[model samples]
Target: MLRSLWEYRHFILASIRAELKGRFARSRLGGLWFLLNPLAQTLIFSIVLSQVLQARLPDTEVKAAYPIYLLSGLAAWTLFSEILNRSTTIFIEQASVIKKIAFPRLCLPVIVWGSALTGHVLLIAAILFVFLFFGHVPGWSVLALPLGITLISALAFGLGIILGVLNVFVRDIGQIVAIVLQLWFWLTPIVYPASIVPERFRWAVDLNPMAPLVRIYQDALLFGHWPQPLTLAVPALVAAGAVTFAFVLFRRASPELVDAL
Candidate 1:
């Protein structure tokens, strides 16, 4: 797998650049929209939850600047959700190229994941600015940010590859993916903190691949603490399993993928 990814390294890089350019090619705001999208969502969520939902999770140590807490979790979730959502149709959207080109089809999902990860970093930077303004300077635990993000991206990529291949044959898979992601977003503790969950339910939340990731983000960025060992272990193992499963499925479906296209 390392060899394959290394061999296609240039293709992956070029695809990343191409995806970024195509997204902002003619837009007035261009890359700015990346920061704006997450910021807008954070603002709307924070207001609505505080006002209407009266939502507040107990035992989560968010400072007086509550948006920082929400934004921290929101950034991680947005990146994971966006990559999974977009990757479902990545190959189909580029069907013309896939039909004509004989390059490694795996690169398509990787590129989409990379582009989404890039946008995620930009959003994280914006969130960091918000934290700084609130006098919450990031501590050394911030170093874990990249690892957390990478794990989330790997999880998203694994699922994306499987979905992208499946969508090629089963058109309905894309619609199902949309609905599943919507449900998955709520299941993740992005809008609310995991600490509030009862002891019994806490295990289930932790079992979610994304649950540990969001906790890591909040731990490092919002709470100035290192991620617990179990927090990292479960999600990393899940991501590895997901990637393995996706690669096998993609390999098995490669021949038919061409036919389906």
Candidate 2:
């Protein structure tokens, strides 16, 4: 699948460009929408909760810590959600092309990565600028940002493709995933901190796979600290398994999946 996808790299690039263009085709702001939507959400959260939970920001030294904490974790969440949400129905979205085109199906997800990566690169840059303006440079821990982003992407794409494959057969899976993500988002510690959760209920929050990834971002981007590798080991292993399993499922189901699409 890797070799086949590489062989059809042009299609992936073209698809990514076309997808971005089509997404904001007639808008005056164009690509700015990608930056605006998430940042706008950040503004609302910043206004509502910045001071309320300012005390729970992991004892970080950064100024404007809440928004940085919020935006930093959000960057990872946005990337994961974009790929996962898109992957859920990517085939269905391109059902017409899938029916007619004889290209590799893996290219679809690759295109999703490219498009989302482009937007996220800009998002990170914007975040960095905000951090600098506030005199809260990320320092060396900033290097770990890519690792956290990659892990979250792998996890999201892994889960997404698995569902995408199933959704091709069962359209209801797509709707179910949307609801699950909403619940998952609240369960995550993005808008709030985990320290405030009661001890008895903390187990479920700890069990959430995204909890560690968000902490990885918070540690790296907001706190300027290297997350303990041991702390990340479990989710890293799970993400690897998710990717391996997704590939197996994709290979096994591609024939029927194409027909169903």
Alpha-carbon local distance difference test for all models: 0.82, 0.85
Q: What is the clash count for each candidate, in the order shown? A: 0, 0
Candidate 2 matches the true fold with a TM-score of 0.94
Against the hidden reference, what TM-scores do the models get?
Answer: 0.91, 0.94
* lDDT tens digits, residue span 122-217, model 2: 788878887887778888988888888888988988998999999999999999999998998888888888887889989878788888888888
TM-score (C-alpha, index-matched) for candidate 1: 0.91
Q: Which structure among the candidates has the greatest lDDT?
A: 2
lDDT string for model 1 (1-261, tens) is 557778999989998988789989989998888778777887898889866887765654555445777788888888887888788898899899989987888888878888888888887887787777677887899998988888989999888888888888889999998888888777788887776678977767866888888888887887788988876897898889989999899889887877788
lDDT of 2 at 173: 98
Residue 198's lDDT in candidate 2:
86
